[model samples]
Target: MAVVGSGVAGLVTALDLLDRRPELTVALIDKGVSGESGSTPLAQGGLAAAVGPDDSPAMHAADTARAGDGHTDPRAVAVMAAETPARVADLRRRGAVFDTQDDGSLALAREGGQQVGRSVRAADATGAEMFRALRDAAIEKARNGSLVRLQGMVVDLPLATTPEQPVIGAWLLCDEIAGGMATPSQDAGLVLLRAQAVMLATGGCGGLYAGTTNRDEATGDALALAGRAGAALQDLEFVQFHPTGLKSADGRFQRFLLTEALRGAGAHLLDADGNRFMLDRHPDAELAPRHVVAKAILDQPGGAWLDARMIPDHQLAEEFPTVLTGARTFGFDLATEPVPVEPCEHYMIGGVATDLHGRTSVPGLYAAGEAASSGVHGANRMAGNSLAQSCVFAHRAALDMAARLDGAHADTDPEPPTFGRDTPVTADGSERTDLRTAMSAGGGAIRDADGLQKLGQVIDDLRAAAYRAWGGPKPPMVRDALEVDSMLVSARAIVDSALHRTESRGAHFRTDYPDHDPVWAGRRQRVQLTG
Candidate 1:
């Protein structure tokens, strides 16, 4: 069995599988230096749970449902919220750490869309603490031979090429850039991996946008691979835009996201004229739901700014050392300066449609975390809920996969398939840059039919170029070609999903159709790539 990605979802799922079924063989594949490049470690807010005395799973579910704008799956939200405490406990047992108050109790903080303080954090680096725990465990297991960690990119989903088909494994691009042993010349080749079951926890496609908090490698490889393999995607239009991404005056720090936790701790949003504007827009002001804050910021002529001076200098330095250091490195002091801020594409609320257990439309295939649309996030994810959902769903998926393995016949292991050669397609680096620009302009925070149509044309042209390269006589640069291919596939999906939903809801705001259509109320949009 193999799991693609090494983020919180992939690591937890892989570890769970190995722990439960010791005899099972598992291969873990990651595109970047495992555990360092994904969105998990970049997360600053803590995980949300109902462990506080004033909080309950029901309250958490209500907050999630409210933020989701009626599109979140009730059952899925209930499951995730209920499992939060247990999942946090599980991580604690596995060496994860969280911030504590002076009384020795777990410290809780609040973010947008929450009624009370229910987020357990590690000062401000909660994601990093949790990821460290999981990564350390996986590393230990890998050393013991219970797991095989492969540093490479999965270029394609080899099996499940058609609807309802079973997935066996993936085609991987092995190269030094991806941490594999293969050199960067024509000698670099493709490796076909065949496993009994394959799971994609490959995060989201935030990198498709020109400005995103997501890592550069988060190019939506899993979504595109699933689309090519005939898997269904849901709610692709609902892309979450975080309200505060740091932009320096000199442009040295362009895409660093000033964590939302700062606002939760009382930081304010200031306009170009140095006026606190959010107070007039929403009652919660800086604590409004992310979509609301992002839209408000985008509406400003000079773009919105952040006044971190609202938080004390000592608090800024101790609580958010990473953010403070980044600001200082760029000559901006978080405790005094009015840092320029803008919304950046942050998370994807939609992905390969899957059940709560992570089973997709195809058999022998599963997805979790941002890669899978489990409907816990619905249209817009509440802050801090992402890590919670990833951990809980990853646990469920692992158990389901293990159960499947136990029920399989004694000859469950299939004969290894022959390695297949890949026809490399040449891709221009400039074209990749163009694709990001097009996606940001069309499918970003604000959209309309005209821009979306233009974006569609761009994707069509790019797809044609990729196909031409795929069929050409020369051996193509497979990795570059695949990245573009995946971006094109993902871009088209977002556009199509946006076009299909004629109403504005949550993160998806249509300029032409500004009002939420009653027709779309309580309904979720879905799309599949067919060509």
Candidate 2:
């Protein structure tokens, strides 16, 4: 078994599999250092679970459905909401530390679109704390030799010739293994690890946008690889725009995310004129669904500001030490002044289409986390549900894989795909910058026919240029080139999906067709690659 990401989803799957079958051999592959890849550690918000006295799975499901704007699959959302408490408990038992109340019960926080406090957190750095726990557990497993950690960049998955043919393995590029170069000359160093089952836990495609909260590694590699392997992707246009991202004094870290917990704790959103504006936008005010709030912020003439002056000073220090430190370092006090903010590409609501068990259209291939669209989020994601969805579905995938691999019932081992000394795409940093700019300008918080068409043309042009470079006499595989290729591929999918869906819903708001169409409510837009 091979897990392609080292985030919460991938690690949870690997660890759960090892726990179930200690003798099983699992290869944990990551694009970065094993425990430090993807957007997991950068998560400022917490995970949602219906463990509060006033909360229930039914209530959570309703909230999830409302947030998704009627496109959410009831079954998938039910599974996540129902299993959340158990999953949180499992994490707690495995050394995850959740913030506790005075009585030591799990302290919960609220966020946009939630009716109650269901977010279990460890200060404002919930993802960091959760990753620390999971990472420590993985380190233990590695020490015991049940798990092997491989650090490398995955360029492609080895798909079979037939449409339904199972994937046998993947192509991995490691600096040490590739003799310090990813070119075809170092093909000997490019190792192919065969496995019975492969899981894609790679995170979202936020890197496609110029303004994003995703880490650089989140270039939609897994989504692009799956698409190239002939998999169906759903709802690519439904990119979730977070309502509040911190504005950096210096241009360097301007994309840093300001967690929604501040708003959940009664913070107000103010426009540049020092006016409380969200009150007029939605009845829920600061707690309106993410898409609504994001649009309001984007509508601001100068910029949006988060006013947390109403939140008590003691609570700010105790409940959000990380956010406080970050704000103070940037010369803003959360307890005193208003922090500047903007809308950022936060999560992609669509991804590799999969069932609840993580099985994709292609056999022997599975997906989970942000990489897989299990239909739990539908058109829009409820706040704090991303981490929960990742954990629940990843656990389900691991269990399913473990059961199938236990007997000879698994598909027979197929021969790995043969590779030629392939020419890799060439690097041009400007191409990536241009792609991001176009994606943000045209396909961002709002989209229409003309803008989406223009973005699609840009993607086509950039893709053509990349392939031309690749066709040049023996180009070696460069990381930057591959990243741009993946970004372009992912961006195309988003543009195509946005173009197909003419009506506005969830995060996919179109100014030209702003009204949500009842006809398209139940129907999901899917995209696929065909020869």
Candidate 3:
């Protein structure tokens, strides 16, 4: 078995697989250092689950369904809510300590869209702490037996000899950065691995948008790779824009995400006149659903301001030390001033369509976490639900895979493909910068038909240009091929899906169709590449 990506979902999946089936052989691959690929490491708002007597799984599921705008699958939501408690307990057993109240019960806080206090956090650095815990557990398991960790970029999924045959494994292009070339000096550029099953936990497609809280490596490579290999994608148009992303005066540096937990802890959203604007937006005001808050910010005159002054100074330093410290790094004191904010691409509500057990349309392939649209989040994802979803689905996928391990056969390993190694394979800084700039300009928030159409054309042109300059049977072409292919696929998917919706719903707001159409209510737009 092979698992791509090394984030919380991937790591948890591997750990669960090992725990369930100790004799199974698993190889975990990551492009970067294990645990740094997905937004899991940067998650600030904790996991959302019914951890207190005051909160119930029904209420949690209702909020999830409501936020998803009636499109959430009830079964998937039930599975997530029902299994979340055990998942949390498992994390605790593995040394993940959650913040607790004086009475010894878990400390629960509220975030946007939650009707009850259900978010379980570990200080302000929830993602970092969770990553450390999971990473350590995976490493310990590997040391004991059976798991292998590989650091390299996956170029493509190698299919069986026949068309639409089950994916056997991946073709990896291991480029040598120091000498700016491929290995073996002349040929043998691609390395092949055979696996009985493949799991893609490759995070979200947030990088397709201009302003996003996603990591730089989030280029939608996994989604594109899967799509090219015939995976069905759903709800691609339902991209969630977080309202409180830290924005500079010039609107640059939009990656910083201010967690909604701050508001749950009594912070406020103020405008330029130092007046609370959410009061006029929704009854819940500062704690309204994320889509409502984000739309409110978009409607506000000059974006919004996150006011951290409502909380006490010492308490602020204690609960959200990471956020406080990060604020200081940007020359601001959170306890005194309001942070300038705007909505950026925060999460992709849609991804590779999968069942409750993380099984995709194709056999022997599974996906979990942000990479898979498991029908838990629907149209708009709740603030703390992502982490819980990752853990729950990872466990499910692992269990499902373990059930099939006895009969699973060794994949027929095919001979490696050849490529020219004489060409340079160094990371092109200029190309990377260009890709980022283009995505930001054409695909940023507030996109229209014209902008998307033009963006698609430009991306196609860029892909063609890259191929012309570097494509010729060389290993260096692998990065160019992967990056361009992923970008084009993502752009096209978003644009096509956005065009089909034709109505303003959830995170998708079209100025042309300013109001939600009753006819489109209860419907999800699915996208697939036509032959």
The CA lDDT of each predicted structure is 0.82, 0.84, 0.78
lDDT (10s digit) by residue, model 1, range 306-407: 888878888888888989998787777888778888888899889989998998887888899999998998889999998999999989999998888853
Worst 10 residues of 2 by lDDT: 179-188
Model 2 misplacement above 4 A = 160-164, 177-188, 248-253, 407-426, 472-475
Off by over 4 Å in 3: 162-164, 175-189, 407-411, 415-435, 472-481
lDDT digits (tens) for residues 1-531 of candidate 2:
888988999989999988887888788877875445688888877999999999999999999999998899999999999998998988998899989989988899998889999899998988888898988888888777778777777777775566577776777776454321111123324677777778999999988888898877789887788887878888888999888888775644366787999999989988888999988888889999999899898888888889999989899998888888888877888888999888888998899999999989888888999999988998889988999999999999989988878523234444543332365444547778889889989999988999999999999998777667767322245667768768877888889989999899999999999998988978987788652
| Model 3: per-residue Cα lDDT over 115-136, one tens digit each | 8889999877788888889888
TM-scores of the candidates in the order shown = 0.92, 0.93, 0.92
Which candidate has the highest lDDT of all?
2
Cα deviation at 72, candidate 1, in Å, is 1.0
Model 1 segments beyond 4 Å from truth?
A: 160-164, 176-188, 250-253, 407-427, 469-477
TM-score of 2: 0.93
What is the lDDT, from 0 to 100, of the residue 111 in candidate 2? 87
Worst window of 10 by summed lDDT in candidate 3: 179-188
